[model samples]
Target chain A: MPIHDVNVMILDNDGVLRREGKQLPGVVELYAQLEKRGISNVLLSNNSRVTSDGLVRQMKQFGVKDFCKDQAMTSAEAAASWIRHNPSADRLEDMRVFAVGEEGVFRSLQELGIALANDQWDGQQWSGLPTDVVVGFNTKMDYATTMAPAWNAIHRGSRWIHTNGDVSYRNAAGAMLPANGAQLAYLSTTGKEPAAVVGKPNREMAESALRRMNVTQDQARIAVVGDNLTEDMGLADNLRSAGWNAEGWMVLTGVTTAEDCDDPSVDRVFQDIRQITRALLSR
Target chain B: MPIHDVNVMILDNDGVLRREGKQLPGVVELYAQLEKRGISNVLLSNNSRVTSDGLVRQMKQFGVKDFCKDQAMTSAEAAASWIRHNPSADRLEDMRVFAVGEEGVFRSLQELGIALANDQWDGQQWSGLPTDVVVGFNTKMDYATTMAPAWNAIHRGSRWIHTNGDVSYRNAAGAMLPANGAQLAYLSTTGKEPAAVVGKPNREMAESALRRMNVTQDQARIAVVGDNLTEDMGLADNLRSAGWNAEGWMVLTGVTTAEDCDDPSVDRVFQDIRQITRALLSR
Candidate 1:
């Protein structure tokens, strides 16, 4: 299917719109074209560090107009929704979450009325036991204080959920630094993987993004556009295999280059998000 | 072979003689019996939290007389020695080590004259690059300040070594706490296992213990006595497989009970260290 034929557009935030903290060329134009075509769009990001409000503000700074918080979906938001709506969590009126993350994770959980377990590394009153353990990107986490307790809680039967499984993220210096997946890797040494990972490549975040756009998988020919093939194209492949008419539009703006897009799973390859936008506009 | 035929006896410190900071029954008698039989002994422990000097002092307090620092071997000491004697380390006079550990790790590396990389979690003068990264049991390790740099150094091509692979250790309150192996498990998520592990089940520590005892592996019919099957008996099985006339005498003292000794690797099973001592003295 052509890019213009898609009724819903799911775009990745970091690589597609911005690269290493700067807005990429043609991002604003791409967003404007989507708005002009009346195509429902959701800006999806696996970065659990920033909330949807922060992402909207970031997109506005990039000169993208009319992009509201509702048009944005983050792993943190999806994770919060996943825990709240889960059938297993229905047993409790309020779920006690032992969280290891920054403000985005805390805010998202609070917005959903989930009680945060007050078990911190700082010597103080310890909350009795957590009902669930949620791990995100926490820069202030220490192994002795923060992680030890979380590991103990998980061993003691708390459900474990990680926001995303991206092992490394690019820092301001453009160097890849260890991310949430690295922490999860460390925690998994206790002999169990997380019960759920609410992020890209794992259908939950994609489904949430699609749902937020008021588009059903069957009702729309969706185009998942992003730079990284594993997270972006993998999600498209997964959705297609699940009977959705979805296609992955690989771009050479961030991690993957044109040479790496030879995988048959990628439906189309573009020089960047701008090229895809130009193609759709030309049509 | 009977227990009396063993010329050298290697004992595990915890569970075999002490448990949860308390001395076990017949520990002093067991040491005395080894001394009387003219068997050279070394107390091996995976605890990297304490130095060899500290372990010697602890043994003296437990009423085990004549237990000197030379008769004690820890993962810390083994790790330091492993780095020093390694063929890859021959080029560097003093290797810049990125150490994530406590007093034991520091003291062991200092004693061996290994230079520590100046890179810390706090803003300080950064060391250019580390030749090696060493991890021991650190109670105060946090992700931001300590682990981040270690992770960075490993990605930058530093050889990684861990003290042991035990996931957790019993704290003073008998609660299981994350150990060095747990930290290693976390770090390993970055897609590389440690190049070398210098603790139990690895022949480096056992070889170091044997060297300190002034006995060659060929000169002795060695008996490794411990309560844990994986660490203690596994070490004996490893040595025996490597052509050493070695036996694993499993003691139902700490982690493992009699039911766990059904494995063919375990040569003998005794109720505790006292029972093995009695059987040896009777011969």
Candidate 2:
């Protein structure tokens, strides 16, 4: 229940560690304290556009040079891991995916030996039929070429899976931009909910992260610290409801403001990752 | 309320007159009977892609050689008409619109002496900031280039308007394709409803059609005949609710079936336009 008692910490990327392309204060120290306490941590991010490798590089830029790919889990990676574990076909290699995302999504699926349908986004081109229509955060997806085909495929009975549920993401200028949830809403006009939304607040991504960390949800003392209440704190709430010893730690470093910290989802609140590091170091 | 007493008829294009690009039986004879009786008819279509010119051409193809531009009203035309009457600024020319649609939408807006913002759909190219963001049926809309910018504009204080609410449209192959409603849903993740949906079963298009036909809603004996329940019969319901002498006439030629005609929205049911023609002639 205390900061030191937390055996594993699941930290959000955009707000808790780095923000606006810069490493936030105290993330390096928080990592160091977790290492000193012999506590495991997963840099869990709902950003489906980045791979574990991309996350590790970001961690290195944040002064955590020791952060490895094993310590990082992106929604894209979680999607691949989830798909690999829950195979739609008899064989893993036989599974065809029509993925709408960047390199992270493509790489993760490829690592699991999943064949991608219509990989290229070049003008009105298509490959084999997709068994699964996987939607991630596609910043450059076109409706006629990419989405219409995906919609058609889904209508024709392909299983739909979204990477996350965040409809809008804040840009550097503090402007809201369309995210995967918005993309999901476009397809949701079909009146079918996705088979899986493998991201934050969902059990799939957390389960995958816990498995990767060699920790069981029911036994491990987990703490999910995030700036977004619905995603980060909500993830903690989900874990607790699932019978895990998890707490949702809110940080006022991103979207969540001081006024929003009083929510039931927030078990604990910190000004930023620096305050969290101070709390951990003091204990 | 008798069939012979109907002075003006509002017919849906897709289901009532034709289906999948071919003319349905009884439409020609029905037009003949209506012309002989001096009863006015307006071809009301929720499809924003086609202009009045296109509808006239389609009518000619359907063997109704006398059908003119004045007898047709598309959602695109309705949108322009709605905007012209309800201008965002003091003058219509001063109000800029970022329209997401085909040539029909462009032509309609242009004809109303309204300025268009970002007319071209070329990649990442933008002309100007929009005061109004109008969404119509665009089969070729892209996310990064078109929708994202529109989403950004809406968030930054732009009035949003959708031409129609039908999410999907049946293609020539009988497969449902993404329509403007799907595009509207995509933008709806902003948590804001459109300022106006200038299509049926909304009152804007129907009212515009009434004006075009020189018939006031309160006095004119109106019959709305279409195959779909929600858009067609629903228009009649809306009209009647607004104190109009309007009857919903259901046709069995389109999306609606024989069993669906039992709903409260249906005032009368016929096999097709031919059956309606027979009833009219007999009367």
Candidate 3:
């Protein structure tokens, strides 16, 4: 079915607009075209390694002048907002978060008033320090290093949380290898799962993005466009399944391909956002 | 890339072939066809839940008729052989084995003439009573259950041995979930891994299966087929990575699918053994 839509488009940042830290061929041109038509578009992405401020700055380096930091929303900021709103949750200050993660995760906890501790071990004698929340998203972690805190936490009734359940990451070598989330799973000693995950495919981030856009599910008339089924297309599919006025739109550039477009979960497929924007304009 | 010459086939009995006492589709039919092809196919599975004889009998109900007692070797049997063959290892006839598994595992020890004790309250309580090796697989397992004999054995410097490191089982809903291997990993809580693990993906199982076939690696051609990339493909890829003559084959009916075929480790893709056998014959 043709998506008869207006007003909102959720654009993926990495592949649709940028490639290898640089803007792609049609990114600037497409954005200018969208701006000329006065269509509402926001760069909604799952990457948490960088803050939205950092993303906006990087996008500016590519001759894109129209976009600003407020327009770019990342999963980390949404995670902080999620924690803030969930009042019955484990108090951020009281909980000891064992963060085996990146700078963005650190910044997220700081915003939530959640205290975090990274590798103090650094060859020090290992101690049974209680980690109240064992957050998974660490790149430089090993079995013992990751387990030391989780072992303390689960036994102590501390919660476990994963950043996102992304199983693999792309490298300079062009190999899609096991990501930190899967590695965290291997080191989980107590068979406990993350108390909460605040990333793509999770409703927290999507709901936060929609709220920030100042549009209700019925009034927004939104379309989610991305590459992966589980993370991207599945997000919209899940929203639709849950009775949201949203539909999954997929692209073939990254994690999911043109082949996965055939899956019934996906509402529409596009070669790129430029084509999608044009199609939406006609609709 | 197209593959050539499938001389040997290894099968996973659980989930991939038979799941929770029920045989999956085309299992017996595939078995009869492979048996007619004269392929050196062995069921190299990781189901320590039952003994090899019991498993063979279960397979019989599913229409498998060629399995003999000797041919249906369990990891326990391999562990027994390893102990008997090692000069530094405990002598089978004179040894005391503390078992943490079912009747089949204990029966193997009893039939092999190893001493058995009803160890309770830490094998240490029965310490002076004679304990040689502590064997772990799966019983109606509990913390108190393992702690007693396990602690006693660990304290006495009694050797530790485990069957396979399979972390989970498939649910009735077809979800691949975690299993007892996570508990065995906790035996490190008592300090030390089993002296050896015996089944698929383990070099010992590969070596033993190859030894029983009486063929050198160069002379032996092998194709390993399974549904799980982590377990089945892991078995094949691990063998090949260790320089064994094996090609990692994938079947969609079990765990992985053609959708995730972009993964580099999958060497051959087949719907089932029937198609693979037909292709082999034609080739």
Candidate 4:
């Protein structure tokens, strides 16, 4: 509601950081602009399939070369961190995982010592196998590949988990194809919803990201940036739902287009991430 | 994997059925014995909640009536007939007339044809208006409430549609919970995932169910019986993995318990529906 208290700014990828594999104009000046104002910014991307290092490497190819992996938070890393702190979590190393997801998920989980027991897209391939944790950040998912592990793990008292529930994603065909959430929906046919998740809109992600920025609970003033309501804007809604003044900045870029401008939950809509950053700096 | 051919037989409700509130049993007879017959059977549960209608219902209720409404399939009347003709559709009504979900998805859609709107569980709550179509079909769902029209008709374009993604049921606390799916999820979310669905499973549901039933354009005979796959045994996985000698049977007893045993699927497993019925008949 009030703009002055907002200091630490976390940016979204795709639109805010880069478009068409190219950095948006004015990004260089904006960073210089934010630094002059003593503002600390973090780039958080929901693309969990790609590592933070990859984001930094690729954005550098687009001339926003100064981006730091340390200054970034991808959904995958955030999820891993949160799971680590979970009081009674299963050991990350020992869990039999059925990863129906992209490269980022596999690499990050591996880095965290979470073994990938299966690499099939649909959960069907993993059925009858002894899988415990079923991670869904998949991009190349089909019907059979998604539901099998979910049905098996959930029935066996294993953990039913997801990286995020971002449903449809803008495909190469420009049509939004099914994302993790859609795959999860397919698994819903198994009639088992997720037992837990570590992704956007969940309090754990917000808490961990803020803590990483060294912003204490009381000292923290957070703002979630994204495009969709059920996911991006939902992040802010979830925060507010939990009594935080978290506001959502919806860019008419990806996911929810300008056609969906009337979505009531969207606190504020912007042309793109560039505009959002410009406004924050102006404030 | 190649799809396998199998024969399936389903049972009708009201006669060989018995129920209590909304739990199903007697399905075991349908599944287990049939499994021994080298025929795989999946109970087509219309219950939208869990994977299958477990055995607790029929055993306790004494028949198949205690089925969850959302999990059961369409009767000879209601939207069942509609789906028989227009199998590939996403909406049920296109005019603003009248409707709700509790009474019946069909009657509510019929009201829409004449241009009278009403408050249905999955329908809109009309206020002041002679608007388009109205749909209704929710139990204990109030009608004649003026606000109903405004929300259903006035809010969006007229052509009202009634999808039975109804998500209302008594929870463990004995308090009503929201279910059926998109509509109820929207009702609970208020401006989240819009309410736009029709019939059961829409096209996706039909195709998947048909696949599970082991019926194809090839040499295959498939019969689907059950109280409801939507609410019961909706996740019944007797026929998945693209194909492998599968057949499906949705039982009206105890959800999908042993009732599927006699189902003509490649293999059938139920709490013992056929055995119970045969037992009852012999007795």
Backbone collisions counted per model: 3, 0, 13, 132
* lDDT tens digits by residue: candidate 2, A174-269: 557788888888898888788899899897788777887889856699889899988888899888888999999988889889998888888898
| Model 1 misplacement above 4 A | A87-91, A120-127, B87-90, B120-127
Q: Mind giving the per-residue lDDT tens digits that candidate 1 earns over A46-155?
A: 99888999998998898876789988988988899999888346665557888888888999999988887855323322356678888898878886567887777777
Q: Model 4 off-target regions past 4 Å?
A: A1-5, A19-23, A87-93, A119-131, A143-146, A241-245, A257-268, A274-283, B1-283
Docking class of 4: incorrect
TM-score of each: 0.95, 0.94, 0.51, 0.53
User: In model 4, what is the error at residue B62, expressed in angstroms?
Assistant: 31
Most accurate candidate by lDDT: 2
Ordered list by TM-score, greatest first:
1, 2, 4, 3
Model 2: CA > 4 A from native: A119-129, A217-219, B119-129
Report the C-alpha displacement of residue A17, candidate 2, in angstroms.
1.9
User: DockQ of candidate 3?
Assistant: 0.02
Q: Whole-model Cα lDDT per candidate?
A: 0.82, 0.85, 0.62, 0.49
Ranking, DockQ, top scorer first: 1, 2, 4, 3
Deviation of model 4 at B46, angstroms? 12
Every candidate's CA RMSD: 2.2, 2.7, 20.4, 15.9
Write the residue-wise lDDT of candidate 2 on B1-283 in tens digits: 8888999999998988889888888778989999999999899999999999999999888888899999999999999988988889887768989888888899999998888777532333334558898888887787766788788778767898899998777777566677888888889888888999989999889887787777975669999989889899999999888989999999898988998888999999988888888898893
Give one digit per residue, the lDDT tens place, for model 1 in B1-283.
8667888888898888888888889978988888888888888899888898998898889897688888888999899999888834666564788888889999999998888884443432134767888999888987666777777777767789999988877666555667787778677766777889999888789987787777875688999988888888889988888777899988887888778789987899888877886797783
Ranking by lDDT: 2, 1, 3, 4
Interface RMSD of 3: 16.8
Q: lDDT of candidate 2 vs native?
A: 0.85
